[model samples]
Target chain A: MSGRNATIEVGATSSALVALIRSEWGKAWSVRAPAACLAGAVLLAAGTAFTLANDQVRAMQTGEIPVGTLVPVAEILASSVMFAQMVVVLAALQLVTPEYASGQIATTFLSHPRRWVVVLTKAAVAGVLGGLTGLLTGPLCVAATELALGDAPRATVPAAEAAVMTAGVFACAAMVAVALGFLTRSGVAALSVAFVLLVLTLAAPAATGKVFPGVAGSALVSGTGDPYARWAALLVLLAWVVASVGAAVVSVERRDA
Target chain B: MRIDDRARRPAFRTFVGTGRQSGPVIVVPMLQFAEISKRYGPVTALDHVSFRVEEGTVTGLLGPNGAGKSTLMRLLVGLDRPTSGSATVAGHRYRDLRWPLRVIGTHLGGRPVHRRRSARAHLRSVALTHGLARARVDEVLELTGLADVAHRAAGGFSLGMGQRLGLAGALLGDPAALVLDEPVNGLDTDGVRWIRELLRLLADQGRTVLISSHLMSEVQLVADRVVVLGGGRLLADTTVAELAGRARDEVVLRTAEHGADDRLRALLPDAAIRPVDDQCDDGAWRVTGASEREVGLAARGADLTVLHLARETADLEAGYLTLVGDRGQQVDSVEAR
Candidate 1:
């Protein structure tokens, strides 16, 4: 070893939670996983918008489309939101699984011994990044749709509502994904379970006419369901987020690092 | 607090004499494990094991491959909870410390790092958790000789380099105590010697250093005290010299006069005297329980011309083997229960 001075001073002034949050943020972006997943989501959104816009433009050129057949910006934004939510879920699952797999969680515990603090800090970081991903991709999807349907009377949801709803959905999904990741501590297992949950929640509406809160709430955000259904869906999705995240926190605190 | 001048001096004198200080000493140990027992389902990994590592000393945790050395270290660092009892550093549980790295630094066995992160990024990330200055990362990188490759991905590093990165992470906080498990596993000869010197320097600075290794000779060379474990149970906890002295010591002697062995035997009836070899014509006797001085005096009293006389001192390896080997058999019988 070199004889260079290795003395380091520990700063104990800051709150442990804030330090943990900063560390978690660094950990989330330390690798290419988050960037790759977010980039993939944006690309998927752009491609979907380009394909739909091209189809509409071709129909107008051929003079075969009916007048006022507008593809609303909300519709395009909704599609991109769905895609981004998928990526967020995958990204959130990835955040904790690799640590557990490589046994880096032990080091994590060494840094911040309270398991709950680490879990909550990671969830907060992933949720914020997920929200940012939605914020960036929602407008990109709208711009793509606007470019495709040039000169058509644009129909769209209010900008503020679109931003809030889209980001809220992505953040909630990301939190749920983080919870599943902590519960399983295995990427494959967590991903498998998340996929199953998504399918079951998505199919619940079709099979039972929007009885499931997640489905009803998603439809409300897309502006397809009644106002009462929207309220009920919001409550249901919030409950799911709360339950999933709570269980994850408890599991992590009780289990060994 | 700034590092004092006394803390910077090399602890050569400390190493040469007894591992403790000469003046009035503080009684508090830097690290303590009290009745700590860990059980994983049907297997007991640690059984009521307890030991204190004093400040200004290097304690070696020695055990075989399947022993509970790793489990004990993990317990000390709060990586695992004991099924019963407690482990504390500086009179506080590891989990309760606001800044644990400052109090204790540890490098556990197996890979405990994200392979994809760069060496610098990894250290910085850990540093940020404790609110340490970013410059501390550079300091540790230089200390560990990884400054040139600080930005290199840890996944591509050799096993020895990976170990160095791990040590860098441990030393990042300038902890008062260090708990390292098998630190010399992938190191070369120079790397091994470097660790020994560094640990000695840290101990001399009044830092508590505990290293776990299965290599008896390595521990003998560096450790002031050796804590041996076998089958999840502590076998020996004492100074290196005392451990070696625990083993039987024999005095080997050769005489030019014929029947001198009989005369020596007659002189010390309580001593166990045996022939070194029946086939060899040289009359050499291995005598246990008699000092070399006693044997020489007896031979001189008998007017026997002594050709050679030497006392064979037991080494750490032999003493460790004797301790662990005996305990292994007992542990096996207990496991059958």
Candidate 2:
């Protein structure tokens, strides 16, 4: 009998982790919604930055504000990261929820029975794509704001720090979204929690609420003079990502697919 | 003890430590359920079920609704774990296999593709994990007759096309064993015949094929042996020939005269006699518990003129109903030859 026989060899040509990474990458880009969301994230960030700078410049021209008011171009660009971050959240949330909705999660489990490996790789992929979106958007928004504020008096030219902050925050936010996706396995449930954290309870002014993603993101993006607050905000965002992704991985290992 | 066995243990039992558990090596069956049981809080889905599917043959896991057929197949693929016993493929759990898709192809139903994702994209995603080549994906698409519509979104596909896509995914790795659940659920007649022939060819090429369905007629044409399940319990392990034979054993006879029924019963006193249809006084009658030979010989021994003599061939649905004791079950069609 040829129970193990085949017309062609079927062994793996790559390591398990590499195959998992490649698979997750394919899954992330295969759907039109995630790609659309990522594009929206970039456009929103750049467009918002352009509009803000253009409005500030126009207000100065109209004499509504004082002529010598200091303008922070980098801060204006980084501020738009908050709104586009929601699009990144939706895009990252997609990496986990579609499989569950289409019942393809079962196929994922079947293709690779190691649940932890699959979950972790998925989180990593979503994180990278989300980070890349922010990485490009951050610099693009900076450039767009610069274009809008042509010849305006500038307070600081810290585009590098602002871009890096945008990238780091967006990456961490995506990991949290992917984690939420796996934790809930339902779009409505995950999106509802996302809304509560990102929109509803945003900046509750409470110490605990400061740890919420939206609050931390708002505080971080708004910080201009104090470097310490920015560091604190970054730490809180990282903590959220670590905790959310950790719980999701454990749930996958313990629960049935 | 100075053992004289210099040969590498028996072929059936090989000692190895790279698979499932490390305590001892377990003998591998193509597909085996060793007293496996599953429960969902208060309900037992499978009760100490034990069965084995051999190589180069197609085995049908026959059962009605809630008979645990899907659960058993899921257990085999490591989709669901057994509460106590083990369900292994080739002496290893599905999760234990370094490359599972190469060993066992799985196609559980109720799974659909992302609506906006193309068919090629769906298969490619699965193949990417297995490190299978893009050529392999195209090969499967061609093999399943989906190459023409490979670029179409699966959401727009018809029922038959969807099933073909599922099978394409299963065959991506060219696994040795194929485990499918209700593979013919929404298939047309052509789809049904196509799958039947495909399964036969796969088994003929030395692959173990196990399919589950509630409609016995679905498997009547494809399966060689059927492992019947009822209420999550094993009811019968028999050949398709045995199940199909239920449609036989009674002979139909027609006499030249309308009132020859009494003479026929008198001639074959040991046989149970009845009319083919009671509404009409036609000369046709059904004789049970007797072969065509006995009826013919009895009629010849007497002066009875026989117009028509033939053995009865009924549908397997009646036999399945009798075996499962579920008269409310409905079969899609009666295809007995």
Candidate 3:
């Protein structure tokens, strides 16, 4: 209410999307749920890694399995991703669901009239934060597991592929959550949909898992069986991301906030 | 074509009106709603409603519950697309503007903030969108008297705090126009007074402000112009004085002489005069279309000794209720949709 002049300086071309992403970035970190998810993922990752590697080492000592059994470091991290995946999904859902539930989305649409930009920027923020969660937790989990191994031969491509593959899958899952958040526009409903999809993907056999909703990001880490290879798996994941983001854009633009 | 950075900064350059009133200059409206119609399936929320709020005025969007007041404000901010026509800020459709918040600030009902985000964080998030300076957050926080609880999470805020936070968000861009719906919903007396003065000051600064509220008394005190909607139709759009003038000025008088009623009626044949009767009072008369002084003068001219004469005080609430009698009921059905 101060009589100060309304002196705001803005440039048109690069302002909307760039400023949105920048604003969304600060928003992602400032909220509690996302930061809490990241912290919980890191804690659970380290715990899972240490326990899995220790169990393997103890099995060798007891001759329950052969000694020098190469600890599956990548497998341990992948399993950790599965455990933390739901948390990541919920966090991503928080990106937009809370807004809809509280009716804050109207203000957001009011802020940026072009609905697509807001939808895209939210998905991007979720994807980046989800990817960051993977990048931080994956290598650290591998490090924890390897530290427990103590010269035990590390097995498979997991040593080299753990961080990037986990990041790809986590990032895609987060994007999917963001898209579903817009599609459902309710926290409970979006989380339920995301949960059911995750369960279907996880419960499927390896042969059919590659075709499921989230298997591509996982298939990116390990390998898809027979007919569909890693590259095709990537395309599948990209297709889901594209379709989700597309639906989100349509929901926000074609329908009321 | 490249435009100078500073010239394009406010995001919308005010579109001057070629429309001339009586003077050399024409008053350009900052907010315009032209034939805006919105329907959710069969229910028409707003039906071809059109009105414009001129710059430097606090226009009240007044209506009863579900009177399409909020619906119109929603359409104005592009929260919901109209089935036909357009609502514009600064002479451009809301969606077409590149930096909308820099041109018009809106608060539908607070930002619906995340429970965990602090007030400062919430303001900063909005400020960052327009690349507004960080100090703008503190300035608005202080302006809304939220500087004390700026760092607290919004989850624990009371209704008044939440409203103040919403106002803080709306002011982040220092936009040229503000559209607020039910801005005083939960505010205490002090908060209500603060916002009233705030709206007054903002309008005084040549900023266009449109506030939607069902409280006729509040709108009467704060708004210069009112655009009243009833049952999804435009009912009244005029200045506060003009709207109040819509009511009939009544002069009630009792004469000392019992036969003066007949003489006064004969003296003023055109005025709507009726005797207030309970079968006993024959001298008391209610005169319409004339002030108390006029009524007394006419009685004197007729040699009717007047014992009592008083005019009923006119108020906006009475005028507003009379304007939309029994028609505002349709708003409830449409809102149910």
Candidate 4:
């Protein structure tokens, strides 16, 4: 028989890819990763409302409308997504790195001899889970914050857009974390590198905005360093995910697992 | 051994749209290594080593600790790429294979299984990966003697239990070929025997099985053909019978007589004679190398007494040691020169 007979059937490859996504999501669902991320989003929303609530009480006492008295649900949801991004990065670092450290990757790679398939499957699962979590948590946080603050801004289309934009950011960052974990194959090293990069990204723009006035200074917002420039951040983060994950997958196949 | 056509099970047809055999002959080589070389920075792991693994035989990749046994196994499964050459399993390189898990099974490190998941779940994941029926999970679990603990979490398993679980996972897809590296390392005596039986059965089923081990004794019992390597080079590639024949350098003999050792030494030049120092050796000499008839003739010629004259047979370990030792000496002398 030609050695080509050894090629795994297409049916098997598709099934394996599906199974990988299901199992990865299953693992995340079973653990504290998703729940913890939701909690962080809830906390951010509550914190944003508490600030609005205090501003309202002070306005009532003084018999005057407080400046920026009502916090927009859009702003609250955006902050919620930023907080979710932090939690997702932590989750990716903690969860994905175990497969490498515990030698599970060996079995995983052995099971799906196609290296790129495995890498892409893992990223897809992580990205999907991050999206789902944001979809669920974003609206819930907005609702809770509205309830907490008596005169809080109601849910708007912008809040939904902000939520999706937030989800995209978190998902991109989480995927990057997974990719880095695979490349470094060391949990602590990958997480440290991830955290350091995040810090640099957050810090460099703020420093640059401070040095330059007007357009540049307006780019630095408090919650995520800058909201207007987030598209650029998203692109940079996506590129990171692709390059790191591509390198990791290729190296895994070309070199030893 | 001839395969009995009558004993062949009916071709399995799971469903109308399920897996179907496309051809009569699966003519691809079981495994092919061509001019494979691996270098780790300043150190070379394997150098231009090449070999083939055919179906229905247990092929042993034998080498000492630094001879690249693990490296070669890694290269074969695409865990590590060859620096120059290529290794193909069945007919395709690992990365090119569409469904790898179902085609070729590999057990690289004997690391523990996923402790959080049950053995059954572990097998299920692998089976699912290959699009194999879920029933195959239980089949392999049972085959590896892991049925009793199939529902138990793999994390708390003993080392032997973990090894069995790993084996079960490897067999999940009913792979056509198996590449196991030190599969018996953590296995107990029973586990070792179980693997030996398992490999033999797989080979008997017309599947290629390549097992790598530095332990000659482990490979000796199972390997039909041995590929002995030293310093990352192929030293001896032959059948067990051939290796045994080549190792038949010493002939054993025993006699009871004072100064018989010296007399036998004098009779046959280059003959090694030593006094038998066992509990039964009461002034008896256990000499070797000379044939039985020659020893008798020597005894008569020396006017010595004969007690025991049985030829000592060389076992696999002895044969392996002899082969490796000879190669090692040649290497040492070459380095010296």
Chain A TM-scores, one per candidate? 0.82, 0.87, 0.86, 0.70
Clashes of each: 0, 0, 0, 10
Candidate number with greatest DockQ: 2
Can you write out model 2's per-residue Cα lDDT over A1-257, one digit (the tens) per residue? 22243322223334877988988898888878888999999999999989999998999999987787887775686568877888888998888898889888888888888887888888898889887887788778888888888888866545666667788878887888888999999987887787787765564656557767776776676675233387788887888888988999999877767
Quote the positional error of residue A163 for candidate 3 in Å.
1.3
Q: Residue B222 deviation, candidate 2, in Å?
A: 3.4
Ranking by DockQ: 2, 1, 3, 4
Q: List TM-score per model, in order.
A: 0.83, 0.85, 0.84, 0.81
Q: Write the per-residue lDDT of candidate 4 for residues B176-292, one digit (tens) a residue.
A: 678887888877888888888887777666666788876667687788898876777767777876776766645555556565666667777756666666554454665556777
| Residue A177 displacement (Å), model 1 | 1.7
Clash pairs (backbone) in predicted model 4: A1-B26, A1-B27, A1-B28, A2-B28, A3-B91, A8-B99, A221-A225, A256-B79, B115-B155, B251-B289
User: Which is the leading candidate under TM-score?
Assistant: 2
Tens digits of per-residue lDDT for model 2, B1-337: 1122213222122234656575665445678889999998899898898888865568988778888899999889887878879998767777877778877898887546887789999999999888899998998898788999999988898878888898998888777789998878788988888888788777666667899876677687778888877777777677887876665467888877686678777778888988888898787888888889998987777676889899866556656665675543332233211
Candidate 2 chain A: 10-residue stretch with minimal lDDT: A1-10
lDDT of 4 at B164: 77
Listed models, DockQ each: 0.40, 0.42, 0.39, 0.33
Query: Whose lDDT is greatest here?
Result: 2
Candidate 1: what lDDT?
Answer: 0.76
State the displacement of the C-alpha of residue B103, model 4, in Å, after optimal TM-score superposition: 2.4
User: Candidate 2 regions off by >4 Å?
Assistant: A1-14, A58-65, A225-228, B1-26, B214-218, B245-248, B253-286, B293-309, B313-319, B326-337
